[model samples]
Target: MKFTVSAAYYLLALLVCGVQADKEPLKDQSRLINLQSSRHHDVRLHCAHYPDWRIADEGDVLHFHSPHYPRLYPHSSRCGWQFKGKNEGIYFTINCQVFEMEAASGGKCKDYLSIKDESQQSQMFCGSQSPSLTVGNKVTMKFQSSYRKQAIGFTCTATAYLS
Candidate 1:
């Protein structure tokens, strides 16, 4: 009878430890997910300060803005953004929620934003246009002013997908 009790106690201790070990990995995974979700702020800061391209994770909707957004951007300013998916199999979309720039003159934009895809397809916009576009897996965008005009700039959102 004493041996039976000892065996049961040892099994119970093992079960408890196994349960605890399972819980710990789950907790760590949850923490990692939370950190990834919080990367939006870091991405925005990086996009604002850097013009280089960066690959984003799937399902991450990243926000970017022109320098001094919602205010007059500097004259002759040049800003570029290149957003790519983590792999070539992924696709992404870009949409401008708020957009304003120098208006076109003589059928040409003095200050404009250009969006280009990996296929060499490109589009340019100016004035108060807000555009929504999708590219295969990578896209490049640039905002340029012709040293003569500045406006409220633009605010854009990009979301990546694995499709």
Candidate 2:
């Protein structure tokens, strides 16, 4: 059968997607979807919100400091936080938990009430996208959802593929 340029384009597209039928859509996001590290090295989960996320590791102690977030825009993930008088603190380094964030009710994040009822696993929602790690050596995750336009912005729900 004869195929025109347009047909070839669509065919090529289908072939590509067929091969990667089980991958995340927006891997282009600044956040590291799948992460890998050496046994004795630290990978920095850059702060899109915090220009700086460094903490003083004095005697290997984790610091509990605040990170000042900008104002929250309505219907924006960033809006869930930074209220006028609803108890505020800046960014914090969540060392003991794995926190992953997708597009929710707010920008980067809209509002959070802490996962306190259950295991109380400490987590940090660092705006837009959140990068999580296993804390020992290496961590890897995969994106499963296709990229789609939403009220907040473009987002993809990546499947957490562990090493």
Candidate 3:
């Protein structure tokens, strides 16, 4: 009877230790994630992971950064997009990159610009499909069509390079 009690105590101790170990790793990882991307006034989208994801690494997230404004277009210098409502559509520009992040190490991150236009879905041209203005590490997009007007949603895959 005494031996059985001793064995049970040992097992309980082992289980407790295993649970503690598991909790600490998660806490530490979250801490690291928070520390790394604290630059944008605590703005970040942690839904993305490397190598595996639900949607293709193309354009699904909206990262708002005002610094990418003042584009010298044909007529006047204007921001790429002007989203009306919060849930009406998603808008963002991949101008500010995470240089210290491991996922953005190479220029191969496939965050593409997806243009969901049922009217022109059959079209496979560059500008007609999605406006993926890939300039080195930045991708800018302008959805000329609207949901009620033209039904074209844009998306882009953000990438990075070593140099």
Reference-based TM-score, model 1: 0.70
**Per-prediction TM-score to the true structure, in the order listed:** 0.70, 0.17, 0.21
CA lDDT of 124 in candidate 3? 22
RMSD of each: 11.4, 18.3, 18.3
Between candidates 2 and 3, the TM-score winner: 3
Which of candidates 1 and 3 is the stronger one according to lDDT?
Answer: 1
- Give per-residue CA lDDT, model 3, range 44-156, as digits (tens): 22221121211212233444321121221122112232121122132323333311111211443212222222123421222222334322222223222211221112223
Candidate 2 or 3, higher lDDT? 2
Report, for every candidate in turn, its global Cα lDDT versus the true structure.
0.74, 0.28, 0.27
Instruction: Kindly list the per-residue Cα lDDT of model 2 for residues 1-163, writing each as its tens digit.
Output: 8986666656765674432222333356575344222222122232133233232221222211111222222232221111011112212222323233234544433332121111235343433444332232111111211133222222211111122
Tell me, by TM-score, which candidate is best. 1
| Candidate 1 segments whose C-alpha is farther than 4 A from its true place | 1-42, 45-50
By TM-score, the candidates rank as 1, 3, 2
lDDT score of model 1?
Answer: 0.74
Candidate 1: tens digits of C-alpha lDDT, residues 1-163: 4545546656664564432122222335444432123333225723333567778877777788887888888887777888788898878788888898887899898888888988988889998877787887878888788888778888888888777
